[model samples]
Target: MGDYDEDTAFLGQTGPYFWTTFFLLNTVYLSTGFNGLYMVFIGSAPTHHCLIPDVNLTREWKNAIIPVTIVDGVEVQTQCSRYKLDVVRNLSAQGFIPGRDVNLTNLELEKCLDGWSYSKEIYQSNIVTEWDLVCDDQWKVPFASSTLFVGYLFGSLISGQLSDRFGRKKVVFISLAAQCVSVLLQSFSHSWKMFCVMFLFVGASQISMYISAFVLGTELLSKTMRVLFTTLGAFLFYCIGYMTLPWIAYGIREWRTLLAVLSSTSVVYIPLWWLIPESPRWLITQGRVEEAEAIVRDAARKNKVEAPPVIFKESELHSLTPSRKYSMLDVLKNKNIRCITLMCLLLWMAINIGYFGLSLNTSNLSGDPFMNCFLSATTEVPAYVVSTWLLKKYPRRALLSIFLSLGGGLLLLIQFIPDTLQYVALALEMTGKFGFTMCFSIVYIYTAEIYPTVLRNVGIGMCSSAARIGSITAPYVIYLGTYNKVLPYILMGSLTIASSVVNFFLPETLNRDLPETVEQMQECQGLCHGFRKTKYVEDEGRRNQPIQREAKV
Candidate 1:
């Protein structure tokens, strides 16, 4: 056999087996979309103000107790503070009327000591209402969101090694089960701290399931199908899941009810363990030749094709070498690889921060939060379609830089837009999200192609870990917007632009052969070094020559 690609060519490329794998894996992809972004709804802060408990006051007096404060240069009722309730009650008992009979503006104000009341028009209950995560405790809202990414950070570090040691299928199911259970637990959380703790597990399991399923699908599909799955298939399913969140939240206004609905979706995947097969490619790497052959045979039978007598050559059927245990340190060992790693880390972090920063802040944008979320998720569908087509025509680095620049440029423009034209601001933000979505999709394919095969997992893991850092910080970025409306946009825009510049220094990997070793990777050139020549053309020719000779025999 030539390589894993040629060996798998025996199975039909787009028949029963291929389509079966596509639908099964897409199910997991869909689940990830919901689990990943449910926080945007669950942790949302609806319109709220300090609660005025029953102090035997009239309706007019109750309404007048909460003080109006200037937020973002607009006068709005303060969510955290109120005119001292006791003072207000005493004044009301003395026949003091608010606004007309008394100068209420001069009354002493204090933080909401009792609790807060939330508007039930949109969200009946969210974390903001459940735990009083507003005012002095407003910081807790974003911190609760950040806890999930902290779990993501830990998951990215450990899941890959676990999958490699155990198996992709095992890790995938375990993570899925963990995610479902954790989400269920999160719905019943008695306190903010408890919810955050459970969300950590939900975050960890969500990412782990996503990564394992991604690798498993990549290993099982054909090359063309693999590109399609990553660029269009899985990503589109994720978009579909994301788009569903707003409607789900719209129907189930309570955060607990929403979590229950989302967590229950995973139960559908439990039966998929029997339908989806393990990666035969991973099996070969573990020297389980018989197991690998058996899986391929089953695939052939399912595809209605004849199986080859043997799936691997003797040389290919060996356990992974000690060198395969490459660590993250190996990425930094070489100057060229180190440079590329740092650049990728920067790009990944910026893309994630911008993407999630916009996603999480959808509620704050003008227009209905549900509609804004629907529109944001809908924008990615076209973006993925456009990106899928562009991936075939353009070089990876150039496209990445161009998209990053576009995304950053749009975000930068948002800071200068007049707030009076809120629609204009919303349009610009959506456009920016489109650009970032394209970059997000492209970078995954680009990073994989750039790294050598041996260190690919490690490199990707490091990049994902960096992305978690961005995600953890993204909520805080949104929090900054509360201080100054344009600050979050400025920070995300600036960082994305900087990363776009860094993209120019990273190598292009359009038609180049995947480097099997680090030395081969070092010789590759970036946009600064023109374009690297393809090493695979002559290898394909040589491999074809052997087949030609065999035909003559």
Candidate 2:
């Protein structure tokens, strides 16, 4: 058997164990989807205006006190200011009326000293309602959302090392528990600061669990199964959770209650510690040969396949070598790898910023916030389907460039769409989201394919870190919308366009073997020059192999 086949031979590529593991991992992924984007609903700001305190004045007088003001150059009921209530009451006693008997615009205005009243048409309660995070305090909403990504940033950096050191299964359970506890605690916070602090833990734990589960699933599944699990299995489950979030928020209405419900869902996975087995591959690397063999034996039994006394040959068992440890510096030391890494980082940052920026802006879109969120989540389904199909058929560079450009172009067009055609603007935004989702999905596979096995993990890790940086900046990008409704779109659209053009410089990985060494990667630099002809020649050569050898193989 070849080295690649030898490594996975004992775990029957498809069987009971594989299917069970797949289902269990996907279940965890489903729950993660809920916690991942719940911030959209949790921190949503509903329509509100300054509270006109009752000073025993007539209803007309009360109405007259809250004056209309120009916000973003549009005259609307002011959110943060009210007419001096004492003066308004005296004016009302004198039979003064708004607009006709008195010029309300010329009257002195004061801040919302009595606080604000929120419209409860859609939401009964949220972080914005619970703490009055509107008007002057509106900036806190995006800051609170950004804290979650800050946790994601830290979680992404640490989870990999922790998983490798302690084992994937252990890390998965620990992170899962941490996430559940943190989310639950976050629900009961009395102050926004307390909520934000706990939310940091929630974000960290959520991403850590996701990363660990992802690594575990990839390691446990077969090669083809790995592709399916990455693209369709866990990711689709996440989409389902995301699609369900809007409904959950709509139903619960209260942020605290919603969080409690979502956190309790984690309890369902407590039993998975027994159901999901430790990775046999990781065990073998750790020199736990007997334990690894035992897991394989159980898997074969579960699959109803007859097992040999010993699954691996002595040579196969000893095949693992302790190579020199490579770091991020090593990736940058190579000229080709360095260039690829830089391009991937920039591309990843742009995609992440655009994706999250669009997601967080759903509330501000011209439709029901819940329905808009649902639409955004729903778009991912087709995006994933299309991305899976295209990854198999098209060159990575071309697909990424095309998709990025398409998404960016759509976002750019949205700026030209007038408010009168808001539905059209919304449609364009959703379409842009679809394009960004495709780019997001493609970049993962592309990054993995570009780097050799030795440095693949490091290269992808660096890119992911860059993505977190983009995510950390996303809330602020969305916050820019408060200043100018089109600012976020303009910025995200421009960055995406620049990234798309840069993607053309990247080499194509389609039809090429995964490079196993840095030297092999350097040699494949020119492979993308005549991609179709090279692929055809390689296919034809394979077809011409001797019939006897083919039958033997």
Q: Could you estimate the TM-score for every candidate?
A: 0.91, 0.92
lDDT at 398, model 2 = 91
Write model 2 residue lDDT over 1-553, tens digit each, in one string.
1153464476667888889989899899888889988888878887788887656787787767777777645788877888888888888888877788998877888889888999888888989998999888988998898889989989998999999899999999999999999999999999999998998898899899999999999888877678889977877899899999999888898889999999999899989999898887788778787887788788878888877787655666554766678899897666667777888899999999999999888988877999999999999999998999999998988999999999999999998987788899999999999999999889999889888788988999899989989998999999988889999999999999999988887778899888666655632243123211111122542422223211110
Model 1, 1-553: lDDT tens digits are: 2388887788867778888898899888888888888878778888888877877786778888988877657999988788888888888888878998889878898987888788888888888887888877889988988999999998887888889989999999999999999999999999999999998999899888888888899898888678788889988998999998888888898889889988999999989999998998788878787888888888899989998776787865432455447887776666667778888899999999999999999988877999999999999999999999998899998999998999999999988888688899999899999999999899998998888887888898889889999999999999998888899999999999999998888777888777765545643344223213222224733521121211110
Worst lDDT run of 10 residues, candidate 2, spans 527-536
Off by over 4 Å in 1: 58-60, 71-74, 313-325, 522-553
Q: What TM-score, to 2 decimals, does candidate 2 have?
A: 0.92
Q: Give candidate 2 misplaced runs (Cα > 4 Å).
A: 1-4, 7-11, 70-75, 313-317, 522-553
Report the number of clashing residue pairs per model.
0, 0
**Candidate 1's TM-score:** 0.91
Q: Residue 428 of model 1: what lDDT?
A: 88
